[model samples]
Target: MTSPQPLPAYSRDRLAERLAAGPVVCGEGYLFELERRGYLQAGAFVPEVVLEHPEEVAALHRQFVHAGSDVVEAFTYYAHREKLRVIGKDGILEPLNRQALEIARGVADTTGTLLAGNICNTGVYDPADPATHAAVREMFTEQVGWAAEAGADYVIGETFRYLGEARIALEVIRAAELPAVILLVAGHEPVTRDDVDITDACRELAALGADVVGLNCVRGPATMLPLLGPIAAAVDVPVAALPVPYRTTAEQPTFHALRDPGPTPLPEDLPFPTALDPFTCHRYEIADFTRRARAAGVRYFGLCCGAAPHHLRAMAETLGRTPPASRYSPDMSKHVYLGADTRLRAANQAYRTSL
Candidate 1:
């Protein structure tokens, strides 16, 4: 009889600590050659490229590693079957997905770094919409499973819209016996279907199985900064985030308000305001994003969308010189303890003497 393979032992919090101990992981998303070569459509998620230009994938991974990313995520975020079908390479799903993980591992070995398994929502948001739930779960399970099999140190389910999808993905990671982090995508709205509020959502995911929870790839830093406090108040786990700011007036106020029973605004009718100009972003904006992120007690920070090497370099420099906060100080904890109901009750003994 063949011996059984030993299960892997890992959890989410341990992964969070590892990420926190080092410089922030920085990266951006772009299509691989397979997608660029007309094998895939323009808007759908791109597949992992194994048959072509594996060296290019490795090169991209090395760029982030050399650019000072403590963790370099693989480009397997869209390696799920549904996306492969869009790319006409449905038959190559397993091989391409596995190869993406291998490429990430190889780059990490050469660069002496950490590799985050890339898993993402199938770009579907609504759980109640029966039209897509099963498909979503199936894609998440397959991609996450492949990442685990390829020996990823950790898995990242990023840019997810709903908690249901996030929960389903995390369950798969647990079944695979792997450590996982979930990065939810928040809109202008706050509360989600679960009544877990953002911070509470983080706590709930942590309690369920997530090791770290935070936001990524929604609006720019200005908008994202405001939500951090509520999110912090709701969860005890470490937060990791990457805010993807828009490039120009063409992207602002991205969400639409309800039009009365009258004519709805077409895409052509909407106005795009440039909250920050130049399509990229200003130095102060980047610095401010870092400042707010730190204030929110975020343990990890990175960029998306318009972020480039200079922007990342600016963030690294800005954080290096910024003063650390005293929120975790002994005095603060003592004050909190003394303000608690137990402490208050203990201090009320003088009333007994009066009685």
Candidate 2:
């Protein structure tokens, strides 16, 4: 109910010192996951829950921390002033962001986890329009200042579709002297929304002084892996990938377009609207993605939309580390079953031996 006193700011050097320890596992997807849990309204997409329902937001942060997330990112993904204005609650932007940070900071402090301040795409990012560029800068400046004051260890600018806008965000975060990460949403394509080559864009973003640079949201890991190759090859800094947990195909690249007007399905009955069901990735699949990402030199791994605690646990297991306490675990008494492909391969090998 009361505002938290500002914490000491972390310098960029301090952030780098933390990163040098090892890879970081960040947990995002709060907006979509909350919507799935009936905490947020569909289509509205405002993170008003931080102000109205801090417990729900804090509970989510705790889940991620317990699921092995090293970073507890504040739920400010859509808390931008412009976004609040759409809902006629622009007056609450500062309170919403500050409160979100307070919740995350509390969890991080208790768990010894790092807190990341989240900033994302502003729909109006026109390089040619000076007024729009100015507005974007002002927006990020205000949001970053609030996050920094709230004791965020770093700031993440994610789900950006435009390179120009991403650059602006990186500039603002860097100017604050905090470590900055810029993640773009280019689907499976090798180009930005503005038609800039993704590989080239990664190179440029790194030059812009982003501590980390890579992709998030839009596509799932299978589709996002190939895209990360060029980015890893391009940047010397650590690369991050937080893809959605859906089986995204070439046809439906972005998750935003996957929404339907039908009623929300129960959690037990996920991957509804059978047409897009194939896009959903299971927990094991997320583990596989983590393995491949590590092989590709991606050190900062995380999940985006549809990600749950199970997915993060799987990722930790795949990395050959002990996972944090989880609500579910594999039944050791049951015989594990490999897929049909494995069975077919075994049969072929047996036949060859008999020959």
Candidate 3:
């Protein structure tokens, strides 16, 4: 095969241009997937894997791209100083964040996808504590600065449970003069943790210069969809919708609230975080969500937490895209037992009768 072509430097207009045109797909959930791969720990989710194993992180980025991601999001989700300090490794915080950006930068540059620097819920944002609020800004500022220096096309501030925290992130991104996609985590509450109505919070962020605003993470498609319509109607900026691939319901509005009713006991009382495998939505389910989200006026289509490449591929295809990974889409026609192909062995086909 011929070597790939080298393109000119990015103009950083990709996010705005793409959103103005149509939907753009961004894949998240590096921490969960990397933990499952045994390269990182789950509880802390510090993403030191990016520093320890940069190549694997790059490969994952490429997989997401192949599966139809329009952006290669740097895996700095929990690489903040606060998280590292909890693990007694705040010393390498900057290096870790920079490494994550570098790894994602390589994939985006090579594949011609938009590179996005990411900051998420700092977890220490206490509304009453003015000190914690300042700390969060310091964390976001440094991360966004590194992203801008790394030539990232834009920055994504996602999974903010407090509209207040999300607003701070938007302010930092705007101050950097880079486009901001601020996504809040609605969790199980109808409003943000600070009691701000979801629609109003999204509108407030949009008015504050957020290029895009919507809900992401915590809730699954089933729970997240109901909120998208209102928020889309409330905000004029491009709306973003990215839910986890879990079967969250009205009874259990968030994945953490899901209870496995099976006789077999889960490790914990609830089946969130590490034990949500059974609730994972199939690709077809994701496809359905994708179609609904597109129709709801969500221009930025993204997936978080429990997302895998196939889940992303399904969303992409539903958005009218035939990404490169579509080449390997499942074909029952090639199955020996389930398929009707004449080349299939008769013995294997006999199982059609439930043998």
Which parts of model 1 are misplaced by more than 4 Å? 1-17, 20-23, 31-41, 48-50, 124-126, 129-132, 193-196, 247-278, 321-355
Q: Model 2: residues >4 Å from true position, as ranges?
A: 1-10, 256-278, 326-328, 334-355
Q: TM-score for candidate 1, please give it.
A: 0.73
lDDT of 2 by residue, 1-355 (tens): 4432322344676457656876778888898778877788756689888887899999999998888888899999988988888889989988898999999999999998888998999888876788998999999999999998997889999988889899889888877878898999885466887799988888888876778999998788877888887799898888999998887656656654454434766444434323344456888899889989988889888999778888888886776656566446665332233333343466565555465
Candidate 1 minimal-lDDT segment of 10 residues:
321-330
Q: 274-339, model 1: which lDDT tens digit per residue?
A: 112234467567767787788877767777644555555556655672212212212422243343
In order, the Cα lDDT scores of the candidates are 0.64, 0.81, 0.88
Which stretch of 10 consecutive residues in model 2 shows the poorest summed lDDT?
332-341
Among these predicted structures, which one has the highest lDDT?
Answer: 3
Write the number of the candidate with greater lDDT, choosing between 1 and 2. Answer: 2
- Taking the tens digit of each residue's C-alpha lDDT, what string does model 3 give over 142-236? 99999999988899999898988998898888888888899988877879899999898898888777888998888999999989999899978
Candidate 3 wrongly placed segments (more than 4 Å): 1-12, 345-350, 353-355
Of models 2 and 3, which has the larger lDDT?
A: 3
